[model samples]
Structures are given as C-alpha cells and as structure tokens.
Target: MEEVAVASDGRALTVGSQQLAHSLFANYPLTAAFLSFALAQTLKVLTTWYKERRWDAKRLLGSGGMPSSHSAAVSALAVAIGFHDGPGSSSFAIALVLACVVMYDAFGVRLHAGRQAEVLNQIVFELPAEHPLADTRPLREPLGHTPPQVAAGAALGLIMAYLMHVTTNLSS
Candidate 1:
C-alpha cells in the first residue's frame, strides 16, 4: 500500500509515484549524491570559463577537473548515510570505505594515468610530420584530479550532505 498526499494546488503525490521528480527526491542519499555531483561539475565549468575566458560546454561532461565529481558523489553518499544511520552503523562504515577507495583512485591511479597520457601526447607531438600517427588526435589529458581538487570535492560533499541532513530534519 502506498501513502497518498494532496497538495494545496489540488495535486496528488504518492509514495511510489512514477514521476521522475518524485522518485528522485524521495531518496535522501541519492539526492545528496546527485546534488554534489552537479555542483562539482558546474563548478568545473564555471572555473574553466573564468580562466580560459571562453565557455566550454565540454567541461560539464568531461572528467578529471578541479573538484572531482567522483569524490563529491561518494563523500556525499557516505556523509548522508552517516547522518541517516548513526556513524557507528555498518552502512556508514561501508559508505566510508567506498568513499576512501574512490578518493584514493582519483588521486593515485587516475592521476598517474593522466600524466602518462600527457607524456604520450607530447611524444606524438614530437613525431615527424610524415609519420603515420603524427596527425592523430591528442589524448585526453584532464582525466584525474590533483590532491587539492580531491580535497575540495570531499569538503564540498560533506558540506552539501550536512546541509541536506539539516534541512530534511527541519522539514520533518
């Protein structure tokens, strides 16, 4: 059985409503993670535009920029879980571990990969004009976050989760 509520506008909302808005807003952790990801991505876009003085829509979809979206998402999930289920709970512990692994990968393995790509790109650029691969498209270089970017993302996630938790508590 699903609970139903009617709004002042005479609109009916159900607990299991099939609407996209309803479904997305109904889950706290998911909402927090999504918001964090959006914020991080938006920040990347804005910062890139500010520095480059040009609007690059690609930044919105690209990865490996300042404020790692991966870090923001996992950290948001972990913090939200911590708030919903006591920090000492198993769920929180799992979320924390997951966040740790994601942040580690962003800072370590992915960063190294990005560096390697840069080196490869340089090698390709230095190749002779007559070389078959000389004109190939350069590799994507911004594929991992620096340590500061990861830290910024983690902080943003924690702040967003805390705000969401507070607002949810207040509304309830």
Candidate 2:
C-alpha cells in the first residue's frame, strides 16, 4: 500500500493510515487531554521540588497543582473544537459551554468542596484520642484554583492547539 508522508515537529508519518482523515484528526483533542494531565503532574512535582528541594513522590499523585490540569484539557478541547468546527458551529458552541461549566466547577464549586474537606479533616483530627477509630487519619481534600494556575493552564492549552495547527498544517 502506498503511503503519503507528512512532516510534523520533526516526526514524519503517513497520512490516511486510518479509516478516515476525520478519525485521525480527532486525535488533537485526545492529545490535548493527555498533555494537560501530564503537564499538571509535572508541575506538581516541580513545585514540590522547588519548595522542599526534594522530589516528593506524594506530589505526583496530589491535586491542586500550580496549573489546573482540568482547565487545560477542557480549554484545549474547546479551542480545538472551535478551530475545527468553526467558532459558530454547533459543535464548537457545545464544547464552549462545556468548557465554561468545567472551569467554573473547578474554580468555584469544587474548590469550595476541597476547602470544606480540609476543615472537616482538621476537626476530625482534633477529636478526643479515646474515641472509637481515633487512630484513623484525617482526610486530605485538595481544592481551589489560584488565578495564576488557571491562567497557566489556559495558556498551555492554547499554545498546544496553536502548535498542532501550525505543525500539522491542520486548518484549525
């Protein structure tokens, strides 16, 4: 079978390797998700190292990092959809709405919940030592997005989308 080669940020791959170009194009959104998640994890690790001068394993699994990974993924998808489907298209509109809801939840509702959890955990810790199950550890809830965190995530997502467009010659 003949394959058409396309060059990306240094990588070369054959086009039309999949059932359809659309299927292959859909990878943009998926890549955005993975990139966001990895970036968030990396940020947490880097932040921990900066603060304590050590690589803390726990930071890798912790939430509420410098940039909100959740924001990055959603914003990336939204931006991709807008680019692919046209900003006025129904698909883009839906994605935009979903992104707004997700960001709001991360910054507003979920953040509050995490703070509440922290308070609850503190209270639990202060309980009398004689009580049943007194040895149980307090719950740690991580929440809230600092403005800088959200901005960083948004910038990351937008940059990724733009880079994909430029490198892939993707219309978006």
Candidate 3:
C-alpha cells in the first residue's frame, strides 16, 4: 500500500498504493497540469460571459488564457519525470528538454500565429456583405500561452512533484 499525505491546505500526495484510487493519486503532477489548462479555458468562458452576459459555446474551445494548458501538461510531466527518475537521469533530461521546446513553441511561434489569425479574422469580419470574402468566418485559433503562464505551470509542476516525493517518502 502506498502512503498518503496531506498538506496544510489539504492537498494529497502518494508514492504508490495497491488500491486503484490510491495508485492513481500518486500521479498528481500530470493531473495538476491538466487542471491548470482546464482552469484557463474556464476563465475564457467566464470572460466571454461577462462581456456578452450570455453563454458562448465557442469559448469552451477557445484558446489562450492565464496559463497555457499545453505548457502546464508538458512541464508537469517533465517535473514528474525528474522527481521519479532523478535530475540526472536520462529519462528526466529528455522530458525536461522536450518540455522546454513545447513551452517555447506555445509562447513564441503558436502565439504569433494566433495573433496573425486574429488580424485575419478582423479583416474577414470587415468584408462587405456582398463580397465573396464575407462568407469566410473567423477561425478560432488560440493565442497560445504567455511566458508567465508557462512559468506558473513549471512552478506548479515542480511543487506537485516535490509533494508527491515527500509523501511517498513519509509513508514508507
């Protein structure tokens, strides 16, 4: 059975557990990343709701928010790998490098692409109704993650990894 630990704020950590739930509980790093991404999407929906005072199904799929989900997930995975495999481990190194690349793309290339899409969408929206381009709709390309979003994700992942490691150690 894996040992479970709780933080002052009630967060949990575990190394490994025989029970399915407990075993799954140990994988907090990955879960945290996903939760962060979900939070960003939810925020976008809320923002839209506030502006329009109405529900927008499109916001659910819209990208770009306080934190980048992609960055969060990959960074969390890297942090988890680092914790599990050791900083110097080849697996951890690979994961860390991959995470960096992913974050860079999300904040740099993908972000610019989103901006380009936005400008293009604006142009499309301004087209005259009688123009053939009037039928072209704006694509919902995401603005990707910001540097702070990526950094926050990295922090969250590291914290989760550490907590998991500590709990596993204490439980044993």
Candidate 4:
C-alpha cells in the first residue's frame, strides 16, 4: 500500500513518488464553498458602501449582513457535496445536516446574542463616569443574521454551487 499524506491546507494528497497538487478552483465542492464565502463577504462590503455611503473594508471579514457568509459557505458546501457525491450518499447527508444547523444557529442563537450585546452596550454607555464598569469597551453587536439574510445567503449558495458544479464537472 502507498503511504499518502494529506496536505494541512487540504489542497492536495501527496504520494511517495509525486505531488498531486492544484489550485483551489480545481476541486468542485471546495471551490463552491470557498467562492460562495468570498462572494458573500464582497457583497457585504458593497451593501455597506451603498447603504451607508461609506466604504467599510472591515465588512469583508465581519459577520451579520444582508446575507450571512456563514450560511452561504455551508449551504454551498452541502449542495456541492450533494452534486458531487449524489444526494443519497452519506457525505451529502452529513453536509446537508451541517448546513442546516449552521444556518439555524445564525438566525436564532447568534442573532439573540447580538441584540443582547447592543442592549448591554447601551446600558454601559449610560452608566456614570465614576462607576467601576463605566469604561468598558462596547461589545461587538453585529454577530448574526436575520431570517431574510439567511435566506438570501442560502439562495446565493445554491446558485453558486450549481454553477461551480456544472463548470467543473462538465468541462472535465
């Protein structure tokens, strides 16, 4: 049996005599998931610039936007796996469940946490200067996605994964 090593970055699997390596785009599911994530982040930047009339590069790496990047990525991963491995396969089932869990958490638990943070921050800001906790930094309030945000992200993910699947699989 050949001893093989999986790359830490998951870009390739290496055999003793040769290296099988390629760009991220070469892998259908991986590419779909990653590109979906990047596209969602880029969209956040654009939406911020349009709505706020300011360019906020930080949105590219931040959470909570018109579309949830977390939802986009996981949904794309699930769909892509379904396409590549067949919807009835174990891999596809795992991916689909993971996507559902992530999206649900984004809409429910995380959203509540962000809202709570906003309230706490307001309370802190109203505290008297002499209070012991008055100087605490405001919490990060944009930590989750609303229902519409999660829906949009899931739609984007489905489209992106379909496109990636077609292009990658058909062309090969």
Write one digit per residue (lDDT tens) for candidate 3, span 75-113: 767777777768898877888899889889888988889
User: Sorted by lDDT, highest first, which candidate order results?
Assistant: 1, 4, 2, 3
Q: Score every model by TM-score.
A: 0.85, 0.76, 0.68, 0.89
Pick by TM-score: 1 or 3, better one: 1
Q: Residue 136, candidate 2: how far off, in angstroms?
A: 3.7
Model 3 misplaced regions, further than 4 Å? 1-61
Clashes in model 3: which pairs?
2-16, 2-17
Question: Which window of 10 residues has the lowest lDDT sum in candidate 1?
Answer: 15-24
What's the lDDT for all of these models?
Answer: 0.91, 0.73, 0.70, 0.89
> Considering only N, C-alpha and C atoms within 3 Å, which residue pairs clash in candidate 4?
none
Q: Write the residue-wise lDDT of candidate 4 on 53-148 in tens digits.
A: 999999998999978999999999999999888999898999999999999999999999999999999999999999999999899999999999
**How do the residues 1-172 of candidate 1 rate in per-residue lDDT, one tens digit apiece?**
5667766379986755455467568678889999999999999988888888888889889999888999999999999999988899998999999999999999999899999999999999999999999999998888889999999999999999999999999999
Runs in model 4 with CA error above 4 Å? 1-3, 6-13, 16-20, 23-25
C-alpha RMSD values across all candidates:
6.1, 7.1, 8.4, 4.0
TM-score: the better of candidates 3 and 4: 4
Candidate 4 structure, TM-score to reference: 0.89
